[model samples]
Target: MKLILKNIGLLKQAEITLYPLCVIAGENDNGKSTVGKIVFCIIKAINRYKEDLQESKEYQVNEILQEIYFKFRRALPTDDGQIPDVLRQLRAITTGPANLPEQLATVREALEQLEQSGTETRSTRQDIMDALEQIQLITDQPEDTRQSIENAFNKVFASEFDASLLLQGAKTGTIRLYDGDFLLIHLEVNAASGATLKGDVDPINIKDVTFIDSPLILNHHDLLIRSQSMLDVDRKPGRSLGRSYTTLHTKDLFDKLKEPALPNDLFATRNKALLGNIQKLIAGEISYDKSSRDFVFTKNAKSISIKNTASGIKVFGLLQILLANEVISKNTMLILDEPENHLHPKWQLHLARILVELIKEGIYVLVSSHSPYMIEALKRYADRADLKDTSRFYLAENRTIEDRNRLGEIFDVLTEPFETFRQMDAEDLRDE
Candidate 1:
């Protein structure tokens, strides 16, 4: 699956081959999430695709097309040579705009009027001309304008996911790969005017290509979304906090792990697998308390959940939930941003191992990390596989004005994987 992006968000251009269990590692504020958004857009395009994108919203198309039109109009509008620009402009103006359903309805009505009038009228151009004249925009006349808008509506803005929709502190998201393979989990939220806007998404497109299923849009983005402030909530189980901010007790996990569990329990079947993995990861015997709901570990005696628990643990739990619930499946691409949060060096290494397993199982994962520990973990994993120049690793840094084309760093952690890991980790420590 090859995916192409033009002037979409922060990415000017990117061409990446999709691999199962691919990881995207970059610094903050380098358009990590934007890549996800483009993927989501592509999935939506596939969903609403038709012989003519007449069913597509106008304003959405306009956002992209309008930019080009204004640019070309400034450069050379009269140039019939600018038909591509005109087509691009048409593509932009045809997609429905945000908070402008009335405009879409108006455009739909005008098209209907033109179609109805064409039966009685000798020329279809006359009806089109009449419609555009009423559209409050200057154009080359009815037929040209109507056809232009219609043409714009038909072109698809192919994409798979938006990272910002899934990860926090991610803005100016970008598209990474050109792979058209994606899954669209659309979440819509009610608007102030009793309308709805896309809210959340789940995409499985990464650097190494893997196609899972036919693209489908799940209209539940509304329920899964939340603001960054919600992350500040205490993880303790309580009615006063957001669902994503909370943690599960060991006893609760154990009970849920039991077979024939409630359908509503998110981690029921996966909990047992998750527990075994955790124990194996630390090379320890683990026990849980039914009273305090804490986990006790032997060999690493200090690993009592009370003082040893961290955000990394919670993040692992969340990932486990996602896997257990089949949110991410076999032969799917997973784009993960900042997976090293609150994890110790040991756990980071363990995560690297887990990621390697996922890759071997044919699941693609893309991850961006600020932790040198994570970078080192990846180094070790690459070493174990005897991978020369780990081409999967990427880093983002301040690009010189002269090197604008090089917005991020794509490095093959050859013999210097460990050294590269140390340098990056040191840089992060200095920033902190």
Candidate 2:
């Protein structure tokens, strides 16, 4: 998949053609993280929509209309206490053109009855009249009304609604994903207001994408310790408290784990090998104890809780469990933000190798990193004959796709700290 972005955070414009292994490298605050988050948000939104559709098992149109109606009914004035009847009439009237005339007749009869009773105030009569006129307008332009309703519902359910809150200072942006000559999906957002302006394409059965931000660590803990009762807590009051990208990613991971695991045969050979390599680096096997509701690490005839493990181990441990449970597969788009966060230099190299192996297994990895060692290891491993064409690298500072030669330039810049140290040593010797 190829992702194109415009006016997103510090990236004025960036078009990245994602291969199985893709890297976005730059100094801090140069939009590398922003790109990762945007991709994550888009993929997360599409996945959420798919999950909702699958669970409801209803026609998309009907599902959207029902939600809109719920909101529309709630917003109606309660002066008449007849909104429920009004909604019923509206639904009945919009069923077909044949019903329009009959519905209009009913409305006329009701107006007559109201006039005859003379018990209601003029305000009540005016409200009914206005509602009737609106209904007539909607009935007269049925196609337009349906299109308008779909657009309204799409806006309400768009991923940007929550992404805007998670990605602070986001203003306006456009995301376009394409496969070869075909444009798969195009989504536009006004991030400040959490509104999606153009998203007409139905994203059902599209690519499976997962985003990993900093909160993966916290989410890992939640997965180990969270219970059904904890998730059942009333989150209405906390809705306004705002969630970090990590929090949302963690919640999604938690939900995915609730599903039954796929068969072992469904696991690809390369994925298993890659995961095995990571396990070797961690020096232990990470497994969730279903009966105990805890993540246990067993190594050298000793068992320890995952919470007592090191941060780097915890990070890799999360990946281990996700893959073992088959929540991640070859079809998954794995976006990682700073995967090197808590790792030593050697472990960073290990992670780079694991990532390359994931790409070898047909998983698409889009990673944002500031670590030189990780990027260098990735370039080295990706250059292998079988993996050469499966990888692409970019320097986010220039906001352009880069080849190995350009990556060398980035390497030079990243290594300037060594030159500074050398210069300081020379000055100290001269003063001596």
Candidate 3:
């Protein structure tokens, strides 16, 4: 899938055709992280809409049309109290109009009155006009109108309300996700009102999408607190603290750990090598202690609590556990925001290798980072004959003009910091 973003947050415009292994590199405050967050929110929104569609009961075309008409009527003026009467007549006409000509005349007169009422009536007039068009269509092309009403309802109701909240200082923005030449989803956001207008070529199912944010290293204390709170349903809060990728990932991991451990044989075969690589890097085996309600790391004949582990270890430990439990598999779309955080240069290189292994296993990986070492490692791994075709790199800059058309060539952007250091060194040697 290719994600096209315009006027979203710090990203004035960007078009990313996601590869199996994708890297986004940029300096600080250049919207690299924002790109990951936006993609995550879009996927989550599509999943939420699909869930709502499943839960909602079916509605008849006439019923939906009537409901829309009533909603508009309520917003219309009631100065002489004649609006209600007019709405009632309109409602009667919707249900098998006995005299189409008479009913149409009544609707026209009402619309004319609304038009004369000025600005307040503008939206109401449009609503009536839309209803009239649908009503006329129903008389001739009943099926076509039915489909139209269904499409309208889907567009309006399928909107992701919380997506607007993720966007900051976004006066206006558009997100488009396409599958090949066909558009799967299109979202438009209004920053002032936090309203989203959504359109989809077809329904989206995101059951296999996974998003990880910048704080890839999970805090042991926070995880323990959240775990304890989950035990007491009455004390557990309903509101989210902050919907960062880490928070969601932690919650999901906790939930999975709470479930009975899957049989050893049920583990996914594809993650075996990845999990082994993580264990080798950390030099420890991670296991959940159900009795103590904590993660235990066993290494060199000693057992230690995960809370006492290094920050980098904890990050890999999280992935290790998820892989062990079969939560991540070949079909997963893994999105990692700043995976280089809390890891040393050596570990960053190891992470790059693990990501290469994942890509080889058919897992789609998206990474956003500002670290030169991380990007260099990725570049090295991407140069392999097998990965060359599946890897892509993007440079996100804060400049007015964005070069999104360029793909797979970001060597200059990745080595920018080193070039600055080299220039400084050359000047210092010349002065000496």
Residue-level lDDT tens digits of model 2 in 146-247: 243334334323423333422345566676777775776675656445435354544533366666665234335553344321112221223333333324
Better of 1 and 3 by TM-score: 3
RMSDs, each prediction?
18.6, 9.6, 13.9
Among all candidates shown, the one with the greatest TM-score? 2
| Model 3 weakest lDDT span, ten residues long | 228-237
Clashes of each: 59, 0, 0
Local accuracy of candidate 3 as per-residue lDDT tens digits, 97-117? 346577678667656655665
TM-score of each: 0.40, 0.65, 0.64
Ranking by lDDT: 3, 2, 1
lDDT of 1 by residue, 310-335 (tens): 45554454344345544445655555
The deviation in Å at residue 341 for candidate 2 is: 1.8
Name the Cα RMSD for model 3.
Answer: 13.9
Best by lDDT: 3
Candidate structures ordered by TM-score, highest first: 2, 3, 1
Query: lDDT of each prediction vs. the true structure?
Result: 0.40, 0.60, 0.61
